[model samples]
Target chain A: MMKELRTAIRAIIVFTIMLGLIYPLAVTVFAQIFFKSQANGSLIVNQDGKIAGSVLIGQSFSSPEYFHPRSSFAGTGYDAIQSSGSCLGPTNKKLVEAVAENLSKVLKENPGVKAKDVPVDAVTASASGLDPHISPEYAELQIPRVAKARSMDVSEVRALVDKYTDGRQIGFLGEPRVNVLLLNLELDRIKKVSNRR
Target chain B: MAGSMWFLLFIYLFTLLVLSIPLGLFMAKVFNREKTFLDFLLVPVENFCYRIFKIDARAEMRWTQYAFALLVFNLVGLVLLYLLQRIQQFLPFNPRHFGAVAPDLAFNTAVSFVTNTNWQAYSGESTMSYLVQMAGLAVQNFLSAATGIAVAIALVRGIVRKETKTIGNFWFDLTRSVLWILLPLSLLIAPLYIWQGVPQNIHAYTDVNTLEGAKQVIAQGPVASQEVIKELGTNGGGFFNANSSHPFENPTPLTNFIQILTIFLISAALCITFGKMSGDKRHGIVLLVSMILLFVTGFFFAYKFEKAGNPQFAALMQRGTVENMEGKEVRFGVLNSSLFAVVTTCTSCGAVNSMHDSFTPLGGLVPLFNIELGEVIFGGVGSGLYGILLYAILSVFIAGLMVGRTPEYLGKKIQSFEVKMVMLGVLISPACMLVLAAIGVVTAGGMAGISNPGPHGLTQVLYAFSSGAGNNGSAFAGLSANTLFYNILMGVDMLIGRFAMLIPVLAVAGSLAEKKKVPMSIGTFPTTGFLFVVLLIGVLLIVGALTFFPAISLGPILDHLQMLKGILY
Candidate 1:
């Protein structure tokens, strides 16, 4: 029994070093050298030398002039220090109240939009609380407001929304989505479009 | 939406079924140690490992000895991983300078991985260092899976060999499982994930400005390698807390498809290997077909309910805008999200692509049902086959009793001792789940994790224990389980769920190995073809439904009824 225990301990130590220490370090070093951009967190760089948001994590956008992403229940909003879902149960009254509160806010924000027309993704806190994309419907809902706010024609902003829209991954893997960060960035770039139908 | 969901489902199934054939055959060859192309390269490595471990490749072990070796090996791994986490602050490659994990959490995480249950009370990117994630968690991902496969191969040997005193050597099975199968598959797939945007660096997290001018932290790590094996081995421990749902870990539709497929690849192939080992490929094929049928049924139920939308949306209900799109990634949509949920839970892999907590009550119930059904619908790698085969044994025993003859499986008698062990194996998890769940609700610490006060609260605790007892690692996302109470209780559940049942399974193998093989006869109960398949499935449902029905009614069923009545929980 003692010998067996000793053997077990030795085997584990050896395997641990091989797999835990050696293998991961090798992969990490190789990736750092070869796949630099991705290995370093796929950070999206803006026009300036400064770093913009990741193409991955969703960010907080409060502008009616900009499109809304998934609701963040992260610390305040989109706080990456802690990542989690609202984890509200189906029957939880707080979840119901929170959704109701969010709905009223959406209604108050969009001057003429009704409560029922609001997309669920717009109101609910996403699992990661850092979901990067919003439903195409949510994006579409904000188009008129965004266009009106930006002094761009409704058609012009709609066209940009369409441009930013990404179909389901590989035709049918995920859902159709519009990256809100990229869309808002595009909205910023479009300083002067006319009423050219 | 429904049409697209169906289309995607068919494509996923088609790819899975077609590909499983070659992979299955390759695994069979690898197990048999037959002349294969990779043999030339891997042979010396395997021999070297055996020599270094002081194991005799030609030697065989009795079932007890095999179980003992496995326990010792896993215990060592458990200790090693535990120590690694405790001392991570002092370890090299800990870019975050994270301190040692609390002893209870360390204990929980250690048992979790060693048992092939990757349940996390703590978030990965924040709490764990890169060193712990790679060396500790990922290493156990490989070794634990190899151990499961080794036990399974030993059990298969017991089934196939006629009155032999021993099963195959544990070391041989472990070495072959890792070297010949898991290592190659993980290596081959890691590059694909990297291409699709999963990171593999040891760099510190990058802080970048958001479009709103708010600061955001993007975590970086050796993700691609860990990501592939986490799925391929059915380990399900994600480098990120959001698991496969996180865009960084699963970026494109291509990565999502690959990830979902990899979850079931080894498990499904092992079914084919089972058939080959039995000298009757049809037996394993029947098991696979049953698994698919159950899987497809659960998948559509989940999809239809999710696509049906929230009935509570009065105005939007008529406008066809009431769908439960909450917590689903629009990048993957409703169909892919539902499919990934069902697929992950159906195996021991619990990597969620969607937040199941936000699913429609019945839709959420499907994933829970899959786990509660013992995850045998193509369960985790080696664990799944052995689990379902236990049902196959019990079913044959049942079928024989109906015909008024002695029960037999693959010409081996299903004696009293074997039946007792099988019954114990089946009963143990449910007992743990129920008892612990009851304890969890009654206790303040467990109650602290509860988000809602009623049935939904019941489900959070139930989900925790089910994930525990099943060795599945996904959470309901609503449960705050990082506390010391859950760490200790669920840690015990994981150990019981894995090892307690495993010991009995090995006992069954031992008992069967000692019995003489009876030749095929007119009176023998069959486990192949349509009738036996139906019987095997019926046995599984009866066991699952009977054991779990009352507790399930209080949670999902009650929640579903309330939702239909326009009552929110």
Candidate 2:
């Protein structure tokens, strides 16, 4: 037992150093060297050279001038103090009422679009409450509203949405969606660049 | 949910099944100690490890010795991890400067990781430091998983070797499993996780302003490296409280699919490894099929219930379309969340892509029931294969009784010692889970953790106990289990749940190793056909249902009935 205990101790220390210290260090170094921007929270920079947000985290876009991300419950909408979901049971009255409230608000924003036409994700709270992307359908639904709000040609804004649309990975892994933060950022860049021209 | 969503579920499972076959073949080669493509990398590293640890690569041990070594090795890890957590305040890379964890929570975490049940009582981003996350948590992710696979290999050796007193060396199995299987696989998967948007850095948390004018501090750390193994190792504790639901941990749908697939990858392949070890691939196929049957059943139920949405909402608002987006990522929807919940629970990889606590009553039932079913539906990493084999033994023993002939499996005559051990292995977790859950409901400390009162609260306690004793780490999240009572009790629950079953399993290995291989005859029961799959599933369900029916009735089932009548709780 004593000898076995010694063996066990030695083996654990060796394995821990190999796995715990070495493995994570190796991966960290790889990420640091190769994927620096993404490794550090994928932080997105604004036109002013200031840290705006991440390419991953969703931000609220209440002014129709920008495309809206999904509704959030992360401490008053995308508060990252505690990343979480609403965790309301499907039948919970709170969830039902919240969705209804969101539905009306979205329809009011997109004038011609009715409640039924509103995308489910547009009205629903996401799991992390920090989802950065919205469905292509949802993005398209808001295109006219966003274009009108920005006083841009619908075709140009539509083209911007198409440009940022990430299709399914490997032809069929996840749903095709557009990154709202990135898309809106691109929209801003497009308008700015065009103005300079 | 649309038809396409249901179709997506099948497509994902089909893809996983197809990938598992080739992966399983590779695993078989690795386990048989045959030459592998990874030998170049493994040989030198493994040889060095064996020499450094003074573990003779060829030396084998009796089943008792093997179990002893496994327990002691794991004990060393538990102590080390606990020490790391206690002293983490003084460690480097703590950008958060998080202090030492409380004693009870720290104790719970140590046992949780060592037992291959990575149940987090506290939120990771809030509680643990980067040093602890990598050194303490990530290290156990590898060791605990290797420990599970080692025991499984030992059991395989015990069955394969006729008239042998010794199984393979614990040290050898542990070393090779990591050197060849785990490390190589993680190398491939971790990089891909980063490519798909999971952050992997030693950087501090980034403070960003949301458009709502609220300050949001995005937590950042060595996420991808820990993540690959968190799923790959079937250790479900997350770096963040939202678990896989968090965008940083599971950035996109592709990453989400990959994460769920990785959880089942090694576990599914282990079945094939078992078959190859026993010299008949059919035995493994049967077990895998039974597991698949249970998984699909659970998946269907969870999906259907979640998709049905809240009927009360339909009535109240007279809405046309109803899809349950509550507690689910709109990105994945009901189908993926349901599939993920079932897979995670069934395999004892308790990583939640969606909150199980928020599922419709019947939808939530499937995962809780999956854990109660002893997690043999593909089980956890190495533990899953061995766990189902325990059920297979029980099934064969029953078949022998039915036919009025002595029971035999893989040409080994069933004996009293083996049966008793199987019984011991089978009953321990359910007994521990139920008794503790019953006690938890009656106690103030335990009840204090229940966020929802009434039946839903009962389930919070029940799921915690089940998750603990079953060595599955997914919690209901409604249960605030960081209190002293829960920490102490569930910590105790994890230990007994893991070892009690493990000791019996090792004993069975010893007993079987001593028996001579009996010849197959006309009256022998065929274990690989359709009937065997049915019987295996039946035995698993019956045992689990019988043991947990009352507790489940008081929890999810009753909660479901209340939901039907628009009762919120």
Clashes of each: 11, 0
- In order, candidate lDDTs are 0.83, 0.85
**What TM-score does prediction 2 earn?**
0.94
User: Fnat of candidate 2, please?
Assistant: 0.58
Docking quality level of the chain pair in candidate 2:
acceptable
Taking the tens digit of each residue's C-alpha lDDT, what string does model 1 give over B485-513?
Answer: 99999999999999877888888888788
Residue-level lDDT of model 2, residues B1-569, one tens digit each, is 36666567677778877988888888778767888888886799888887788878788799989889888898999999999999999999899989999999999999999998989998888889988999899889998999888888778777888998988888988888898888888988888888777888887888876543456788899999899999999999888888999988998778888988899988898888888878899988999888887888888888888888767545533565466666677567677788889989998789998888788889899999999999998999888988998999999999999888999989999889999999999998899999999999998888898876668888889999999999999988867889999999999999999999888888888889989999999998998799999888888889988988988898888888887777764
- Which one is best on TM-score? 1
lDDT of 2 by residue, A1-76 (tens): 8878998988988888898889989998998888888778888878777777898888777777788988887778
Candidate 1 fnat reads: 0.60
